[model samples]
Target chain A: MKMVRVIVSFLAMFFVNAVSAGVDDTVWKNELKTQFFADRSISETENIIAIEAPYRAEDAALVPIRITSKINQTNDKYIKKITLIVDKNPTPFAAEFNFTPLSGKADVAMRLRINSYSYVRAIAEMNDGQLIMAKKFVKASGGCSAPIGADLDAAMKRLGRMKFKLSGTAQSNEPNLAQLLISHPNITGMQMDQVTRFIRPAYYVEEVKVTFDGQPVLTAKTDIAISADPNFRFYFVPQSSGDLRAEVSDTDGNTFSQTYRVEP
Target chain B: MKCIWIVSLGLCLGLFAVQCQAKTKETLEVQKIAPGLYFHFGHHELPNRDNHGAIANIGFVVGKECVAVLDSGGNPQQGLLLKNTIEKITDVPICYVINSHVHPDHIFGNRSFKGRGVQFIGHKNLARAMQARGGFYLQRSEEQLGVKLAPKDIVLPDIEVTDSLTLDLGHRLLTVTAHGSAHTDNDLSVLDKNSQTLWLSDLLFVEHLPVIDGSLKGWLRELKALSALKVRRVVPGHGPVMGDWPAALKPQEDYLTMLLKEVRSMIRQGKFIEQAIAEVGQMATGRWALFDAFHKKNITLVFAELEWED
Candidate 1:
């Protein structure tokens, strides 16, 4: 009965196309604005970051969002965290990612669900406690409930298969692009398992840490907005051949870790 | 067949798996739809042990100085056959290799056209869709369908049509329009202006039941918009070629609309997907091929979306 109430309320969000249901868009923005910034002063500058998604989402359930930091500063004033928000989703908060000096440029790309044609905003939290935002309007609806492509059993069985691929030949001591894939449903509580006729409990990758030679490169704190079988693409300057490690922990407290050797 | 419903799940599941070898190449037969426009008709056989995942319609359009391939065959071997067939005809340089969407049966043969100096064209989302599912499809082609994919097998679109773009095949011209997610997120339809033929490429299913990979609402909207286009003929991706445009678009529209209304009603009644799967759209089962295998999936997908609708 409570689930019905939640779904109906979510549907109302769809019907009203209310920039902010029960609150104005600016109000919702300010609310999130407060959470990410806290007491820190906010300077809305276009200098540091750009958020990119297709003007029209090809697949609502798997809309790819790419965030790039124009500034390559390593520490101190460097970007400390990145957060994503879909103003119209049933659950508006998407994700927040953290970066370290080893992460050559604070550039990362991941996919998420866009429940409706809404403004998808990405905010970067600087170490100095300043927050800046970039926004893109994504035209998509009904992403959260899109049917899972894989069988429920198979999807559950292969919950943590990991694969890594180099974008190009890793030149000695050059910034190399790497792709990491984790097999996961990234289920939001709203989804119903067709097989069992029951709602699938929310289970998603909560944190992901990428390290090169045991030194932290990047740490991503994600949420249900992340797509199933999430993929992370980033850059790292490898000094020499070393083992690249990925440690992912989901909301279910399930930790999956794998190490892929960087080919010389 | 025993019933009209074809078991298309064979191709999706690769029902009979085998290790494919380079089979003896066969010559492709192309039917002349209009002057200089030809299409290769495929069998209704499921993509199984015998067919080698080659059950979709494919063809090429010839212009004055060049030619444009509409959709390639399913596997590398079938692509070779289609290529050999083109060679047997007039020798016009292939200016464009247009993929209808990211379906394996429609794209795997792209390997045969590698290095032919042909530009592969598709919807803007084709590359991403291929990136998301290419590896799985490549693996399944071998594991389930017995077709081994080569390095150049899966072709990503070089020319992405975000809105609408036209290709000049010599004196003749063909318009390619990118429609929002219909059968798939990357469904691209071609319109040959010289001849009044609209290549609906999975947009309009003639006899075969439609598969819903993208949005059901979007697909229905597409059909409504396509019904207004005054084309003399239609070339469907999986069914019989049609001689009429709007008239031929009825059954599919009715089918989709029926599912839409029924699914919405079921959701209002608080029916779960399992109950709606059996109860919704039972009246039209005999009118379509692969109704049993894909119909429920369509219902499942559509219900999942409409259930969230207010």
Candidate 2:
């Protein structure tokens, strides 16, 4: 009887692992790594950076993701760039964030379109070229292929409109949180027109630049994976009041810029 | 004598098999809400494998010439069953299958009604919406709803209602009006002028919670305009038919308005979407069924839209 019970428990454990293994197929190691970072080693560790995402995304089109860094930005040594990738999406390269020393912290929060149940990974590259990564498995599907916007007409009417909101009073030499909201549909081009039999062309924001007093804080190269009305929350160090400005450019060659005056 | 016994036994077995088949085939149940208006009240439950995605109100209106089907059932099987039920009630050939919106529960059954002379109708934006979501809906049908579907299952509307199109169902005239972005970007409501019955599919949620796939502000705007219409009874997509015209619109209006007010305030307070989802819309939890399933998602969508408000 004891032997039978032990064998039954072992079989149950094996089944559970097999089911979970199918979910986290680890396509990143074979495909994503070779395609993105060839010959360069990326350390898969949580010490340098940690990714926060809903285990089961509430909205596939707008899954909120936050990447926090363990080390603060310093002139001597700081993280230079962070790349976010969703493994199972048609285009897995979601966004690449280039951070400067003026960016007091490397933390970033944004919404993304996750196409399937896949791993969302954020890899941080230090100024010295060392890469460290963190990832979370998100259960979501059909975000890229879902209709562009619930209110596509409304989104089109206010295309390229941008806004900046500062969370609280800025302290000099310390990281202050700011949110940048841009109005764009970020169409994935995967949607098909049943009648016309024509595929909608992909139109999305390609570049975003944020500056604090003319000093670059965060610059991001985004793709269709970025959710509609792309909203980003990041930190910048304001040395005694400055003009915070954001310039956004999309695939259609439309450029929009907005500036908010900040006081420390 | 042996040959006679064998023939008698075979006849008896055949009769039993026919009886069993008849007993197992479930027929759709519908009620006559008005003079010529028939309504099938769907149970308030989430669409699952057990229910086969037939969790929405669907019915037909009979007139002198033909019959107009309001939103079809959730799956192709339900659509077939609805067709059978309509045939049992009246010999009027189904002239029009009017789709209320692009949601699967309302439009998935469109395939079963595809035939020559039977025109499928929807809002002007319905074609675009259907095209955009058709692939995704087909991919998820088997896994999510436990129903396997092919590309032929997604039927596009032959006639589009940009503003309002009136169909002569023989003696009765049904006016199909296309509204702005409310429940969805492509939402159509049919009004039977004879019986004064408005088939506002998914526009008014009676017991079930109202889902916001479109703009929150837009839905509230639509309710204001639709309330002024003179109607004796209304049929919702999820709940029972109501005799009160505008009075029946109160519960949904209140819930939506409250969500707008609360989420807007939270945005003004410099709160995040995460915080708003957790804190907003707590007062009306037990008032509506399926609040747990859709309330948080509603909050998330509302927060994203209202946060952009100036």
What lDDT score goes with residue B160 in model 1? Answer: 92
| Backbone clashes in model 1, listed as residue pairs | B6-B290
Error of 1 at A167 (Å): 49
For A1-264, candidate 1 gives per-residue lDDT tens digits of 769966865565455444322233563456766765566665658999998776665446666678889987465568888888887676778887777766777788877776656788888887776788888887652211241332233335578877776755787665577777787868666531221223347788888999999988778888877877777777777788898999999988989999998876
Runs in model 1 with CA error above 4 Å?
A1-264, B1-25
lDDT values of the candidates? 0.74, 0.86
The total number of steric clashes, by the backbone 3 Å criterion, in model 1 comes to 1
DockQ of each: 0.02, 0.36
lDDT of 1 by residue, B1-310 (tens): 5342355555534543422222334568788888888888877555653477788899999897888888888888778788888777769877788999887778888878877578899898787556545644554454335556754576778899999998888889899999987887788999999898999988988788877876688898888888889988899887888987789888998999999999999766645445676688888989988776567667766764564354
Model 1: lDDT of residue B46? 55
lDDT of 2 by residue, B161-257 (tens): 9999999999999999999999888989999999998899998899999988888899999999999999898899989899988999999999999
- Cα TM-score of candidate 1: 0.54
What interface root-mean-square deviation (Å) does model 1 yield? 17.8
lDDT of 2 by residue, A1-264 (tens): 769966865665466446433567467878889889887998987778999987876667788899999989999889999999999887899999999999999999998888767889998999999999899998763211253467788887889999999887778889999999999988777764544456678889999999998999999999989989999999999988889999999999999999999888
What DockQ results for candidate 2?
0.36
